[model samples]
Target chain A: MMKIVLGSLEKLDFRATVENIRVVESVEQLSKKNNEEITYFLTETEENINAVVRNQEHVYIPATSLLASHQSIGLHIYFDLESYPFYQKVKEMISKEDKPKGVFRFRRTVQHNRNHSLLTGDLYTLSSLLGKPQDIRVKQTDLSVTPSHTIILMNFGGGTMAHIEYTVSDRERIELEWSGIKKIIEFDSDQMVSIQSTRKPTQPLAYSVDAILASARKVDQELIDRLNDFSRLINGGVYS
Target chain B: MKIGIMSFAHMHAYSYANGLTRLPDVELVGIFDDDIDRGKEAAETYHTTHYSDQAGFLALDMDAVIICSENNRHKEMVMHAAKAKKHILCEKPIATNLADAQEMIQACKDHHVILQIAYPVRFSSPIQQLKEMIDNDELGEIIAFRTTNRGQNPGGWFIDEDQSGGGAVLDHTVHMVDIMRWYLNEEIAEVEAIVDSYFHEIDIDDAGLLTFEFANGVVASHDASWSRFTEYPSWGDATIEVIGTKQTVKVDAFQEHLRMFTNEKKSLEYVFWGNDMDFGLIQDFVNCVKEGREPSITGYDGLKSLEVSLAGYESSKLNKTVHL
Candidate 1:
């Protein structure tokens, strides 16, 4: 059995709020304050995540990188938007807009520690909603030293236009349009599973805890891959 | 606690009356309406006395009055009730304009009585939960907001500019704007809007899209309209979507329902089941009066939210953003 030591929290039973995993258990090693014996740390941002493994050389994989492990969270067409809930309302708005674009502007926070920026995470999960993107472009709105607020517009294969907004804000949502028929996704934390959208009679998108473990195996699941891909794309991956 | 209702002009008075009935400790002392027949009918339905004279009703041994008068008549009713030393719960879009709303608020303050605005949507448990989360900063720093409060056009005085103030923008905008402001704890910095009579033949606007930038530069856009026509499954919806650095939260406060396909005349209906927003508001008001505390939804909140809807009209007319 792989030894997993918990942090901040004394113990947690994932029997509820998550599915398909028992890798989590209360361990004796957590009480041993030597600091070097623990190989895996399961902690939240409030637990002082930086002081743990993230600040040191123990290797830190943020929720954005870890949640990207599953291909079901992958960029593939589940079905047309017609099959989606609120179909008529979405259809009515689409017909009204001559461009017929579906925007998904959302924000992602970076784990800043001097030179390194937590490169990739939320964009991959939200981009999957529009299926695989046929093309992607970056438009930086706010002038900052470290791309503090960036507006990335994507053209998906299914003809949906997504605008991904990144910055510090008190809320998070995936909108169909800036001000049209929209679907807002609420999360307690970024690593939440069995997620429920509050309205539009929001459909819950659930993932198994096993997928989180599967994500650890795929090194490319790190946000760094998307950042590299964006660089390559910007360096002429495809010409308009 | 003894509470009387003033005016049967706004239909919400009926719901407020029903809410009064649910509370074991509160009594519906009487009702006063400019329309005698309407007041009498409501009094009979709620099993309360009807006072045709506004002075007669205000003179009653009541602790508070719920003013469900016309949008234009709110100021008069509120002022009368305040001087009578009765705490007030006035309906949304507190007055037709800012000055009246301000004066109404000031009178309540001077009289040292509680003045609550009837923004029942905030009593929603999910919305309350979201507010708690926002208070705790569970989502991080909130960035932008998108909201919708669409409803079927209730014909009658609601369409009359003199009685109802404005159309869809006035009727539907306050509830959501009040919620947004409460959640962010911020005042609007600017307003931009497009208002038109697209759904109806009325001169007053039946549709509007309002955009607001808060004092902190947090932006929000609200689609307030009376576009939900007859034969729709429900009367309307109150939906909100917010984006923050941490996560997004979206809620349709009235979405708790079972869709019913009926063979009856009404055809489509949503059999709603959830925490009663009106009852909650009534209970809170009763608690405020009993506990001698401040109201949950204050007159100042009403004034600020009203300021946005009023600005919307000006923004549409000027074809430019109205800076507050």
Candidate 2:
């Protein structure tokens, strides 16, 4: 059985995803869920995680970024844009194929605001898609505003490092870029991921939603598999 | 403006030197380090002269010196620079202890030198904007704060208690505490802390959580830990959430970058692309020197921040709340 405990009850689309899955609004109702049931939380606090853990319910954390983890993750969503085509081109470049050689580094700085939880959630999702990081470092550079900014540095070992700057600003937009020893990648959320390699003077292939979505699906499957293994372990059975 | 970097012990000296060289009106006079090899290499990299003797470097007729020495050595360097009547821009926590910090401040005061404490976050564009909003009452009256300044354990002298004074609590706590003081314009009254060396085999504490009570009734919590793993992104973070009576504001000072996942590296990397806080801070220091004005961030600011960290240590030792 699958159940969702949403902080709000207004979202109806989520209820239709699975037929046998139950949906609830409060933590009280979610805690009463059977041990065999899988529960997804839309928004949960440390206190809530503790409560669920104590209740012994099989909890699957979907929003990994929001909750503070061993690794630092950050995300920011901006809605303002001047040109759609330009944005599309940028997005395509970020999701491009001819990947940069050597260590890849990424960072984002936003204006301070009150949406840190959401930004963290987005980072968590992105990190999940990337793969498990070997090491994680998070620094809170400044925190005098509502959406306090943090610099999350992740080293995936074997020379892969990521530096993210989470910013909260009045302006709404997205920008992405990658810098390597011999290559550079740049993209916007709606644009293509573009790769510029020194060795390959010619333009490299770009990536779009189709590619990113596939990766996202893969991450989702991995999470589910891990959760299943965890359930099996708790039930005193080995995962098959 | 003429500036000489005192040491190359801190990695930030590289970035600061780059910033110094970029200014049209400023000249990076030279670099001095007790370790001649490191100093010579850094000077060569930045295209500046390297001085082996401390006295020789102090007598170079520079208007100011940037001290990037180890934390414990700050007092001695500051004293030497101040005696030479050179203005100083010293790295954070001014000194390891209150006595040392006070002595450094006094030395600078006696010599009539500008002692600017390096609090680069104050110069960050986003942070500056947020400071303005708070000043304008955009967030109304502030109620509380949840701040974190976490980074990966920087081994070597940073982990050595004698050189660094303490570990995460001393190295990380002051940065966020300084910001809190700047935002609230208040001082910490009482402190409670839990410090431990849970992650590494360090003798000093590597992780800490501190709760502070301000005189103005604003309570704040700080997680100053070197809890980040080696593979974690960036160096670390300094994040703050200001909960006000009207609304809450979150500030992530280092959140300007691009995200890249490459198969070649087989890992995700975040490439930061934000206004350089170090550049702005150096610019401010240069401007203050040229204009003969006090830097916005002074030695007193460093002292106040250091006090909180010191209090945190005391609180942890006593296993109870410590009053300032």
Candidate 3:
């Protein structure tokens, strides 16, 4: 049984969300550290059964998209779902294979001098249509030696495009747009963060939840590799 | 002047009939339709006599006949009307085959009658403005064209290959190609296309993405499809994006609409309040008949567009770009 530990207060709400889950064997209390860094995803490791998410600062999400709960076929943990402000109603999504047309707007807030990163929600949303990032870019601000803002743009071919802007703020918020629907997800506070679905910001689409999650995870790993290069350039150390 | 309609099989017949009503100089003498119920209904709607026999309808004292039959039947209807010495306004894609289109053109000439093809897009205000821009050198020398003609699948004879000649590609490609040729005064030289039945479960192709080069070395891309879902705000769209040396202009022919969100059948609706293109077409045909002049859109214009559209299908079948 792969054991995932949610930070501090989510023990009850996590159970409530995945109460009908059948694939998950058990949940155990892992280490509870109070590190308010990034509130996103960590993929399940093959050997390490215990995964720790630091503090009320972040929610521990296994590599999965938001619509996975509706699909019930994959191993997914429902957490921080109600916290997002837009596209909370996943049931009303159009599930057909609609090759998304038009531009994508992706926004993420980082506390550090975080230039740019694709947030988990839009990562899944985009990765569904654009399998692997054919291209990933971080615009050079040149405003300061340690610039605090980052803008990233990705092209999925056939005019399907996405742009992500990372602005350094004290809090965490993420936004993404597909077609006419814009999905914005963020924390109301540092305590219990509930991810909301736009059912803002959208008429949700039922992309292959697990497939999109897997795709998003692959893309995230690529971004991390790119960020690692940035870390070496700035701090001369690998970014955690 | 008195005018008559040959068939009500094509939906445009109703609009053309209404155009006849809007004109003070013309009178709709009668209507003839092979489909008896359709003929009777249209006759009642337009307040005209229904003539079941094609010969009897041709014998009426009408100066012209608007042929709105199926694609395959257009040749026969136009022939009969031309022999009767009635100036003809035939629905587009002239005929199912080039030979038939040639024969229709010959028949009109032999009978000394005007043979006009109903290509209403030219009459659209935006299309006219684009032509004006080109004439005035406002956009400099024309470079390229990107156009889309997508409509909701008018299921029925439109989807039947036997009656309609082809599907969305054939139904839509002709209109845009006609306009493009008129604008550039160039013939299509090459065609490469990807055609498939993506929108509907039917066997006929409902989508076609076509790319071709005009004689003047100008490349053009056309997206023709019946992929618009039922709940879509508007019926469909015909948009042209013209790339010029000085400026690039994009015009959505049906963009003059009010977006309304109400609880009436559809949650979102686009009520179009644009200029009536059909009326313009009918008016032009009437002027040609009275003045004894060739129409702005003639049978050859229809034939050339049909040739390019058919070449797209040939390219798809051969899986290689075909030269015309």
In the range B225-315, model 2's lDDT, one tens digit per residue, is: 7766655556667888786655667787877877777775436766788899999999999999999998899999999999999988887
For model 2, how does the per-residue alpha-carbon lDDT over A51-146 read when each residue is reduced to its tens digit? 544322223322332233311111111111111343344345544534322223333334335344444444444443344444443434236644
The chain A TM-scores for the candidates, taken one by one, are 0.41, 0.39, 0.42
* Residue B142 CA displacement from its true place in model 3, Å: 1.6
Over 4 Å off, model 2: A1-240, B264-266
Off-target runs (Cα >4 Å) in candidate 3 are: A1-240
What tens digits encode model 3's per-residue C-alpha lDDT throughout A80-164?
3223323343212412325533334455544454232224444444444445444343332332432234444444444344555
Cα lDDT of model 1 by residue, B124-242, tens digit: 98889889998899978777776888778888989999999999999999999999999988998888766666566678887676667788867776777776666667777898877
What's the TM-score of candidate 1 when only chain A is evaluated?
Answer: 0.41
Candidate 2's docking class is: incorrect
